[model samples]
Target chain A: MANGIIEKVKEQATSVWEKVHGSQVAESILRPGSPFKKGYSDTPRNRSYVIMNNVLYHLHPVKVKRHGVRLSYTLCLGGISFFLFILLTITGIFLMFYYAPTAEAAYSDVAALSTSVAFGSLVRNMHRWGAHFMVLSVFLHMSRVFYHGAYKPPREFNWVVGVILLLLTLLLSFTGYLLPWDQLALWAVTVGTNMAGFVPVFGGQVKFLLLGSVEVTADTILRWYVLHVLFFPFIIVIFMAVHFWRVRKDGGISGPL
Target chain B: MSDIPEHLLRRSAEAKAKALGIPVEDVLAEMTGEAAPTPMDIGEQPKVETVVAPDPATPAAVPVAEPETPSQEPTPPAPVMAASSADAGDVDYDAAATKAGMPASLLKRSVEAKAKASGASPASVLAEMLGEEVPAAPPAASAPPPAEPAPVEEITESVAEVVEIPIVEPAAAASVAAEPPAASRSGGATAVAARPLAQPEAVPEGVRTQRLLTVVKANAIQQVKSEPTDKVNTWPHLMIMEFAALLAVTAVLIVLSVILQAPLLESANFNATPNPSKAPWYFLGLQELLSYFDPQIAGVTVPTIIGLVGFMAIPYVDRNPSTKPSDRKFAIFMYTFFMMGAATLTIFGVLFRGPGFNFTYPWADGIFFDDLKDWVNF
Candidate 1:
């Protein structure tokens, strides 16, 4: 009697799943080539459709050169850098929810994250470390491209775009460093921006613009906060789009060499 | 014609436009009968007929319409054998036949059969079979007296002369065939009968002579210079590896996050400044340079000129196209030198500099960098 009930339940469960998967709503949500779509099969053409039909996978081509897929060739440094940026963005958004950007509340809010908020400390840690990792990975990716002579010929423009992206990565990291509103964050930024005051003619003006004052203060924190979270990310995303596009346009990854 | 959907007609027009190198709107206009058919439109009928009916006699009849090129009008009677010898010099008939996926003997026999039926020289018949221009027909006056077989050697020898025939203008051929003189001048009764097939009037209105779909030449729309590469699909092959890399990075980041809490020191105090205040690690190298040179040079010039402008210029400056390490030794060496120099400066700034920005080994002075202060306790 128990076995028969279990079998009946099993059949009911299967039918329910089939109904849900094959429903009009599900079909509309899952595009023709989506792996999550009902009746998807593992075929070579379907494999191509998997990339071609999906929005996120649209970043990559339907196929890539065999050698380009090997971990050793690229060391996956560029992909890691991009992935780290995404990780940082996620963690940064979580950090933003509990913390305020003003100098008066910034430190206390950050302190409260560890003491009061759930998983706040962990997310903050991830954000901090992920930013640092992104900078390192971007620099390493640039080095790898250089060593392989991937910046040659048709790839020259892409290399320039990549260099701009690296600079943006550093800018993004630097801006976020000042947001913690601690002694370390304050002094570190002071030392860094003080260097900007040494520029030839517009040194003082540049430093003034960056800080929103003659020196780092409450206004400077808010200014850097907006830059770190919104402005720089928006700019970086645009450049990254061009960078990935140019990679495919300039003939995918460079070569076996 | 009216029953076809607008989109289907538009699509067919697009294919015809692309093949004929005309504007799609023009083709569409012609297809809709909104614009009168040009001479070019009438010209396609015979080519369509050739494709539809591969009968041997049809091709022989087809070329008789070529009064458009007066140079092809002179047909010398019984010059079939003589013209064969002159025209068949350059092309290797056997090699061409093999490449076309037929035996040399089979191609010759077919040519012989076509020549006999059409009363054209065997060389011209061979040219037609190979999709090449048939050599100028021997004079209509010399049309080979019924079924006289030409020698094989003469036929194969005369392919060279066919190269001199100007590309046939189908429009001109269609118009020329409409005249009685040209139709009568065709070599045989079969040729005269085939002339009407090329006439635009004979085709039923709205009958699709060509299919709407065609394989558009890849080069026509985009530059496809690349050779077939050894490739794998991006789904399981590349995406799987990408996912693995992503998971590995996530795992490492999560572990690091759990083990080491991010640094959040005492709130900012304007009065008390740390002894050896430093920039974030990435800017450390520039700060390190601040100690050695004037702030203008290290802080302003170096970062902007060498860091930004100079790095961006590397590709444009290094004209060495070869990606091989052996071939570009100097480029590789220069980049390696810069990398090593930057690493040395950054390392010096991060670990070696202590209180008062003075040189002090981390082992002796205890580490001064506050970012890593929690993780690296001396």
Candidate 2:
């Protein structure tokens, strides 16, 4: 059995090597001590060195000389945003254990959370404020970058992507804003969606897409509840990663003019 | 490229040609073949050239006269020639002069004097060489008649001696071989160039505020003069300031959160409806707008559209230099105006709009009918 497993592994490695490098090249490259090596140098001063040299270094550079400390903690607006996401993930998971999506139980589960769960208010407030903080910080962060002229030259395109992400973030906030569905929430959403009706071109289509109907009824609530809980967050996270990648690619908020 | 001489280009081209396996002879032949015709081709076809075999008989007659004439006459002859050309110059040597154009004539006299010494006119003369049209003149003014202005012009000739002797660079000296008249013309005006204009180079009054801290020393000025650090560098200071602000806000929020515990409003009552519904304050702006307009336009559409549009428009509108307050004036204005307007409108709506058409609600009907409809119906 061991021999068979070893043979299988060898066959897979050969196949992988062939795919990455055609047979002749792979055969020559795989030959040991061919002089040239791939990837970062292992000795030091590069990524591998950074990883091997310091024990606490696995987190990547906390503060790059360029992207800054706020960006480092991801606690600046994006960080606060990412933190809220983490808090939401945690609180959301716990909330999920007790809560049912069904209209019958969803409100009851939330009530139970307030009355029964220890630190549930803390979790709930943290999540709530986290969402708020995420929105506020993200906007603040975008404004900071804008004022800094960080959006010029190589970063111009990224700024456009950032603006898109900002819209996504507002969507996340709006969809989440309706989840509790009290009179305040219902009416607030009613007020919110009513505003969506003014979109010069996309107004009706967007309203329909959002509420699933002409009014904020049960269908509207369920749709938003799903989007708030699931869809928008997933989409935002992918975009958030892309936004950070672009920031790094853009050479870290081009300082001043 | 840092002033490397032509040989380096030649050597590099040769090296490149060799490396490329191109024949050097073919390259050299091509380069030279294209070059040889250029001098004869581009140099003007001189109307007066090929004088080399200048009439053999004329040369013999000229030298025969050269031995007889006084050498002093040769020196004076060059001066006479220069005066004729330079008199026709910008100075107007004024075959006459008014007090105003005196700089021009004295200028010509001085140029004439220098030509008597130098033997050739300068190759080039600038506009100002005609002497400054300034009001100073002891020369032609003293000459009784324009014809006898020759004496004043002569004095200028002598005066040209007192200046302009030491410029000895040979290649530059060649430029003046034909430049003696220009020198005489230039001589009168060197003083006029002394235009004591106000100096922008003078230190600014702002320097009074420029004193360096004792700890920073002279280096502070030098440092700032070159590449001063922006506020971002004072990271510790910013941290302290941010924390101080955060602490103050935290204290206030905690006090408020404790003293006026945020009501955990009755959980999700779908049936027993709250009489007056309200959103979180951050959103009251949108909720408030609902009162002023239709639900579709005011509530659902406008806020979403505004939020998206405002977010998108930020980069376009805020084209300031940097994050500094001095930069981005419009950005600051628009942001402040929008936020304030939104906040104010929202607050006014929540505080005064009074339950948003409350009389239309089921419970408000009895109060509505008794007070409002009773008058209308009666």
lDDT of 1: 0.75
- lDDT of each residue in B1-378, candidate 1, tens digit only: 686756667778888898888899887887787876543322343221111212222333334433343222222222223334425544356865865678888887777775776566676555445432223443333221122223323322221211111223434443233222322234321121112234334457665343111112333356745565577898888889999999999999999998998898899988889989999999999999999999999999999999999999999999888899999999889889988898899999999999999999899988899988889852
How many angstroms is residue B141 displaced in model 2 relative to the true structure, after the best TM-score fit? 97
Docking category of candidate 1: medium
- Which 10 consecutive residues of model 2 chain A have the lowest summed lDDT? A31-40
- What fraction of the correct interface contacts does each predicted structure contain? 0.92, 0.21
Candidate 1 local lDDT, residue B374:
86
TM-score of each: 0.68, 0.45
Q: What value does DockQ give for candidate 2? A: 0.10
| Candidate 2 lDDT | 0.48
Every model's DockQ: 0.60, 0.10
Error of 1 at B123 (Å): 40
